[model samples]
Target: MAMNRVQFQSGLSLPAFLARFGTEAQCEDAVARLRWPEGFRCPRCAHDQAMAFRRAGTPYWQCKACSHQASLRAGTLMEQSKLPLRTWLLAMYLLGQSKTNVSALELMRHLGVSYPAAWRLKHKLMQAMLQDELPRMLKQVVQLDDAYLGGERNGGKAGRGSENKRPFVVAVQTDEQGRPLYAAMDTVPGFTRKALAQWLAQRVRPEADVYSDGLGAFRAAEVAHAHTVVEGEGRSRCEAPSLRWVNVVLSNLKRSLDGAYHAFGFFKYAERYLAETAWRFNRRFHLEYLVPSLLRATVHCKPWSEATLRGVPTFRTEASC
Candidate 1:
C-alpha cells in the first residue's frame, strides 16, 4: 500500500502560518492584497492612487480624487468587527486547514475570545464559505445521495420521522478513473421530488450524468442530463461501487460533525454546518492554499450581521439545498 499524497502533503503548518501572518501588520497586508490584487482603486471615484493612514490603530485608504475613505475592514466580512485582523486571519487559517471542522468553543480557546464572539466569528466565516460554494455546479460523472444529520432524541420519533434529523443532499463529481473531484452538499427541506428538483437545478450541470440510489425523489434528476439508479440488497450503501464516493464523503462529513461540536440546533444551522464541510472538501487537494483561498472568498463576501446569522425571523429554513 502506498501513502496517500493528499494526506501526506506538506500543508501550511501552524509555525509557517504564524511566520507568514502572525502579526496584525502581516494580516492587514494580506487582506489588502486580497481585496485589491491589482492595486487600490477608489470605491467611489475609481482613482488609481490612494493615501494610506492609520486612525486609532485602524488602517484606512483615501481615494486621491474623491477623497473617499475605505477602512481595511470595509465592504468585507470583517467590516464592523472589533477583533484584530490577526485574530480573523488565524480563524480563517484554522477553519480552512483543519481536516475536520473546529467548534466555536475550541476557537474561543484558540483566539482567547469569549464564546459568543467566537461563535459569531465562526458562523460569519461559515457563511462566507457557503457563499463561495453557492455558485459551484458539479459536472460530468456524479454520484448523488440523500443524507440526514442529527439523530432521534430520547422521546422523539425514530428513524426518518425523527424531528431532530435534518435532511441534506450530497453529490460528488468523479473523473474518468472514478476519483473524486468536487463535492456539493446542502440541507434540503425534505426528500420530496420538488425539493430534489430544485437542488439538482442548482448544484448539478445540465449535461452531467447523475447516478443515485433508489430514492424516488432522485427521479427529479431527469430535469438535468440523466439519472441512473443503482441498488444493492443486503449490503451497506457505502459498500456499493456506484455509490462509493458519495458515501465516503458522507461518512467523513458525519464524523467531522460528531467529533467537533457536541451538539447544535440542527434545524436552524444545519445548512451552514453542511456548507462548511463541503467547502473544505471541495478544496481538499490544496492544503497550503486553503487559507489564501478562504481569504479571497471572505474578501468577496459581504458583511454578515449577528441578526442575519441568527436568522432572526428569517432563520434559515430548508427551502432548497
Candidate 2:
C-alpha cells in the first residue's frame, strides 16, 4: 500500500478510499507501513530482525532475540481505538474538505456512525489538527477586533445587536489579500482588560504594531509595541499600507463564522474550531500543498480518546476522599 502523495491530493473518493484501505486488515497494514517505513523493529529490545506474526488475528512484532511482542497500533493515535481506519481517514477528509465547519450530527450522517461516535471522532481530529506550537507573529499591519459566536437567538435582533446570546471572541492577525497569515481567537466572558491582555500576551508578538478601536484594553499594548487607536466618525487607519488589509481580513472572518459555523459554545472548544477554520482560511489557495500536509499530520498523530475528544472537564477522585 504505497500511496503516492499526488494520488492522495486528487482526493480519495469514498468508494475508492474504502476499497483501498477499508478493512481492519488493510488499516493495520497501512499503519504498519507508516510506522515502519524501512523495516519493523522491536519496541523493547530494539531488534531490527524481529519476526512479526498475528496473535489472536492481530499483528504483533516479536523480537527474534528477546521475543518481546508489541502491537502495531501501540504508541499511535489508533491505539486502543475500535473505529475502522477507513472511517478515521474519511472523517479526516471530511473535516479537511469542508469550507465552513462540519457539525457532529452532520459527521454522523456522513460517516454512517452513531451520533456519539461521530461527535467523538470530530473532536479527536480537531485536537490533532490544533497547532501545538505558537503561530508566527503577525508582522506588518495587524487587524485586532472582537466578535461574538454562538447559535441564533429565538427572537433576537437581525444582526450585530444579538451579542447577548453568544460568547465574545477576540481575534488578532495579519492578512495578505484575504488570507490570514497569523491568527488567534480567545473566548472571553466579556470584553475586559484582564481577558484581552492575557490573550494578547500569548498570541501577539512583542513590538508588533497594534490597531484597534477605542478599546482601553489595547492601551497597555503600547508598552511593548506601537499602538494606534481609531476614534470619531470617518477616521480611517486604512490609509496606512499595513493597516488597510485588515478590512478584507476582518470581513472574511465574520463571513466565515457567520456563514459556516453559525454558533459555537464557550471558550475551550471554540478555540479548537477557530484554529481549524484559520488553518483552512490560511491554506485556501494551497489546496495541493494543504491536503498532503494534513495527511502527513494524521500519520504521526494519535487517534483521540473519547474522554479527550469531548473536551469536557473530568474530575479525578482524591486519595483523601
Candidate 3:
C-alpha cells in the first residue's frame, strides 16, 4: 500500500518547535517578523521607520514620523492580553500541530491557567483562524453534504428537529483525478433552499459543478454553473461515489469534534469552531508552516474583547455575494 504523503510527511517536531519558539525573546522575534515582513510600520501613520524600546519592561514601538507609541501587542488579537508571548506562541503551536484539535480543559492543563482563562484563549485563537479571507470559491467538480453538530440532551427530541443539532454545509472540491483540493464547512440557518442558495453564492464559483445526495434543498446549488443530483440517503448516501470526499471530510469532522470536546456551546460558537477545522484542513499539506501561518493570521486579526467574543454569534446573512 502506498503511504499518504500528507499524513506521513515529517511535520514540525516538538524539539524543532521548542527551539524556534522556546523562549520569550524567540517568540517575540517570530511574531514581529510575521506581523511585519518588510519592517515595522506605524499602525496610525503608516510610517516605515520606528524606534523599538521598552517601557516598564514591556516592548513598544514609537513611529519616527508621528511619534505614536504602540505596544508589541497593540492592534492584534493579543492586545490587552497579560500572558507571556511564549505562552501565546505555545498555544498556537499546540493547535496547529494537533490532529484532533485541543479542548479548553487540555489547554488549561498545558498552559497552567484556569479553565476560564483557557476558554478565552482558545476562542480568541479560533477567531484568529477565521480572520483569513474566505478561500476563493471551489472551481472544480465539488461534493456537497449537509451535516449537524451536537446531539439531543437526555429526553430531548432525537432527530434533525432536535434543538441541540446545528445544521452546517460541507463541501470538497476535487481535481480531474478525484483528488480533493480544498474543503469548506460552515453552519447554516437550516437546509432550506434559500439558506443553501445564500451559502452557495458565497462559496461556489459559477464555473464549477456541485454533486450532492438526494436532498431537494441541494437543488439550490444550481446557482452555480451546474448541479448533479445523486439519489441516496442514510448509509447509502454516505457511501455514494459522487459524494465521497464530502462524506470523508464530514466523518473526519465528526471524529475530531467528538474527540476534542466533551461539550461546548455549539449553538452560539459554531462558526469559530468550524472555521478552525477548515483553516487547519486547507493548510494540511504544509504542516511545517502551520504555526507561522497561524501566527501571521493572529497578528493581522483585529482585537476582540471578551465581551465581544461572548456576544457575537456568526451566521450566514441572507445577502448574496
Candidate 4:
C-alpha cells in the first residue's frame, strides 16, 4: 500500500534545509516564489511587471505603471526587519521541526544571534503560527472540554477556583471512524453557557454533534447541534475511547509547555502558546508543509513588532470581527 497521509511524515532535514536555504538570495527567492507563485504583481495597483531594485542581498520591485515600491518582506510579518532572510528561514525550520518546546535561548544558540533578537523572532513566529490557524468549522463529531493553564504556584488555590489559572476550551472534531480531523482552541473569559455559544458559533458547524461531559455550558450546544452529555466514571472518564485524542492532546500540551519553557511567564502569553500547540497538533501529519505553510501565513499578515506582540493581543469578540 502507498503511504498513508495520516502517518507522521518527516519534514526537511537540517542538511536539506541548509542546502536549499543556505544563502540570503536563496531564502529570498523561496519566499518570493511562495508568496507570489504566478508572478510578481504590484500589490497596490495590480500591475504585472516591475523593475528590480537591490536591498541588502534581497531584491525589491518598483511597479512600472504606478512606480509603487515593495520589498520582499515589505507587506509581510518580516516588514521593517533588519535580519537576513536566511536567519528567518533557519528559525522557521528549527521551530517547525522541533517536536517539543524550543525556547528563545535554544533559538539564540542555534542562530548565533543575541538573546533579545532570538526572543523577538521566536515570539513573532509564534504569533504568526497562532494567527495562521484558519477559521475552519469542525463537522461530524467534536469532543469538547474546559481546560486551564497556570496555577502551578504553590500556596495558592489550585484547580478551577485559582486566580492564577486561565481557563480555555478544547474542541476536537473527529471522522466517522473516530480518527481525529481538526481542532479549535482559545482562551475564554469564563466557561459560561454564553461563552460556549460564542465559541460554537465561531468554530463549530451548526450541523455537527458535540460530545462533552455534563457541563451546563455544553448544554447550550443544543442551540446549534445535537449534544450528547456523557459523564464517565473515575479514571475511565479521562481514558474513554470517544475522548481519546483530546485526552492525549491535553497530556502532550502540558508536557510540551512544561518541558520546553522552564522559566517563562504564562498569564500574559498563554493564548499564543496554546495556539501554537493547537496549530502544531492540527498540522502534525504534514510536517514538511508546516514551515512553508507558516511562511505563507506570515506573508498575508501585516507586519508587527515585539512591542506590539507583547501589548496588542487581538481578542475575539463577536461584535469586533
| TM-scores for the candidates | 0.93, 0.70, 0.94, 0.91
Better of 3 and 4 by lDDT: 3
lDDT of each: 0.86, 0.61, 0.85, 0.80
Best-performing candidate as measured by lDDT: 1
Candidates by TM-score, descending order: 3, 1, 4, 2
Off-target runs (Cα >4 Å) in candidate 1 are: 153-161, 234-236, 312-321
Q: Which should have the higher TM-score, number 2 or number 4? A: 4
Single out the weakest 10-residue window by summed lDDT for candidate 4. Answer: 312-321
Clash counts per candidate, in order, are: 1, 3, 0, 0
Q: What are the per-residue Cα lDDT tens digits for candidate 3 across 114-152?
A: 888888889889988876636447878989988888888
How far off is residue 297 in model 1, in Å? 1.0
| Clashes, model 2 | 3
Runs in model 3 lying further than 4 Å from the true structure: 154-158, 316-321
lDDT per residue for candidate 4 within 68-165, as digits (tens), equals: 99888887888867888889988888888888878999999999999999988888887777777647678898988888888667887767878667
Clashing pairs in 2: 77-302, 77-303, 150-263
Query: Per-residue lDDT of 175-270 in model 2, one digit per residue for the tens?
Result: 546334655544554567776665567666775777876767767567766888866433365444444445555556667666654455533466
Model 2 stretches with alpha carbons more than 4 Å out: 1-49, 55-58, 65-68, 132-136, 151-179, 188-194, 232-264, 299-303, 311-321
